[model samples]
Target: MFAAAAIAIIITMVLALIRGFIGPTLYDRILAVNMFGTQTVLVIAILGFMMGRPDFLDIALVYALINFVGVIALLKYFKYGSLSIGPGEERNTEKSSHMDKS
Candidate 1:
């Protein structure tokens, strides 16, 4: 059963990779990459269970947290043009000022 689940996850990951490569927009590619990361987390957990190694769960948890943060950071950068508050806010303000001047 574990093997079956792992196979399914691998298949999903392959599909996600394809989507990421051929996505029509930047957001679509990001979404596909995020899905692939999520599937990797699941695979790690499943493998840990299958091998009776509880420590793998901890690694999987860490990976999940990192993956979430990475995806959020990517999206924030795409939308706001920076990950830091100061730079992002400054950019937005500059755009507003330019509009005001016009």
Candidate 2:
């Protein structure tokens, strides 16, 4: 039933939170956080169905888009010092500069 599915999603979210907290590396934590966000979307959808509210799906879609964008931003932040681009050739130069700085 939908209730059972919702319970399973909650359990998965809890596990994801634990992994995010105790992850050995930054990437591991990022992945766990992303998983948690995905699980949350599922929970929202399930709750929407249970409550007979169609708006929950709309909220879930917005959350999913936000989650996707957030993860991409985080990954870019980790890889590049800044989100601003420095042109085509400068992009490579910037990467090399970043590496040299590290």
* TM-score for each model: 0.82, 0.80
Q: For model 1, give the 10-residue run with minimal summed lDDT.
A: 85-94
Against the reference, the lDDT scores of all candidates come to: 0.88, 0.86
| Model 2 CA deviation exceeding 4 Å by range | 86-102
- 99 in model 1: Cα distance from truth in Å? 14
lDDT (Cα, 0-100) at 5 in candidate 1: 96
Model 2, residue 87: C-alpha shift (Å)? 8.2
lDDT of 1: 0.88
- Model 1 Cα shift for residue 57 (angstroms): 1.0
- lDDT string for model 1 (1-102, tens) is 999999999999999999999999999899998998899899999999999996898999899999999998998888777777544255646677678668
TM-score of decoy 2: 0.80
lDDT of 2 by residue, 4-31 (tens): 9988988998899999999999998999
